[model samples]
Target: MIKLQVIGNLGKDCVVNNVNGKSVINFSVAHTEKFRDAQGNQKDKTIWVECAYWTDRTAIAPYLKKGTQVYVEGAPDIRTYSTQDGRQGASLSLRISNVQLLGTRSSDGEGGSSYNSGPSYSAAPQHVSAPPSSSQLNEPADDLPF
Candidate 1:
């Protein structure tokens, strides 16, 4: 089995469609890469990935708008086709299995908050919930489970 995961900002708003009684939400994520070229020129390459999330609940469609950052994991599908000009082109798409609402505007917060939860990816990743301090993560040699 092959799995792919991508974390990036949404390129455009999502579309919810009802196909054969199943709800499907379609969106796209833009993953970018920055590197130096052979001539020592910095180049930025962005790849767009179309994602389809199939679920019974269409409740989250409203929040899955443009610029909303998302983390998606699923199977990668590379589709090839000929362009109108007879040129060849390919697109990247994903069949999503999991979708999580990281954050949303104050009114759209998944969990009620004093104020709407802001952006989810603006900050670096870390353990935010109340938990034992780092000491627990760096415990001395112990005998529990290897």
Candidate 2:
């Protein structure tokens, strides 16, 4: 029941590796944060997460390039190791089960659609009725603007 969801920008181009007749794609993503401190000073921070997606749909590999913003969900794995400087380090890794392509190239200045544009937007009118039939259209023109 360990589930993790991450939304971030790809850190580098994804690589596909084949081992034991299975395909695995490895990629890293960076998620940034911006916040105001106690003094109202702006601050920014970024978190990096490693993801491994094992799927036969290698077609998605090319799209998982650097700078691609994506949403991934899966189980989390934390590992600790000793660094060369005799310091202990731990990293957060994810074995992604579901990956969604979020947006297009940033250089193009046109990103992908967010859920805001979908039918679920609250501002949109609910259950728009269909146009009137010919009977309703037969009504005499009451407007004098014509």
Candidate 3:
């Protein structure tokens, strides 16, 4: 079995459709990487991956909006097709098995709300704990021997 994992932002909102009584959510993710070429020039390359999640868990579909960051793992597939100009092209696609929300990009290109799809596959806000206080940090360690 082959699996692929991707961390990127969604290009657009997800669409939920029922195909013969099975629910499928379709979306796309864009991952951009920055690298310096042999000439010492920096360049940004973006890869777009189409994703399809076949599951009864459609509760999280509303949060899969454009510019929303996510982590997805699934089986990868490459599809080839002929372009209008008679050129061959290929696209990457995924059959999503697991997906988690990272953050949302605001209109100003900044991070906004964040969520996570927990075990139940529900869209819920993640819990963040505060750092320990100075007094707590000064406490002695436990008496457990090494």
User: 3-41 in candidate 1: lDDT tens per residue?
Assistant: 999877777899999999889999998888899999999
Clashes of each: 1, 0, 0
lDDT tens digits, residue span 1-146, model 2: 99999988898899999989999999998989999999999999888999999889787888887877788889999989999999999999999898878764545444533322111113246787899975787556685555
What overall lDDT goes with each candidate model?
Answer: 0.78, 0.81, 0.88
| lDDT for each residue of candidate 3 in 102-131, tens digit (9 for 90 to 100) | 776655534445434423343577789999
Report the poorest 10 consecutive residues by lDDT, candidate 2: 114-123
Considering TM-score, where higher is better, how would the candidates rank from best to worst? 3, 2, 1
Top candidate (lDDT): 3
Off by over 4 Å in 3: 107-146
lDDT for model 3, please. Answer: 0.88
Model 1 per-residue lDDT at 6: 88
Against the true structure, what is every candidate's RMSD? 9.2, 7.6, 6.0
- Count residue pairs with overlapping backbones in model 3: 0
- RMSD of candidate 2 to the truth, in angstroms, is 7.6
Error of 2 at 50 (Å): 0.4
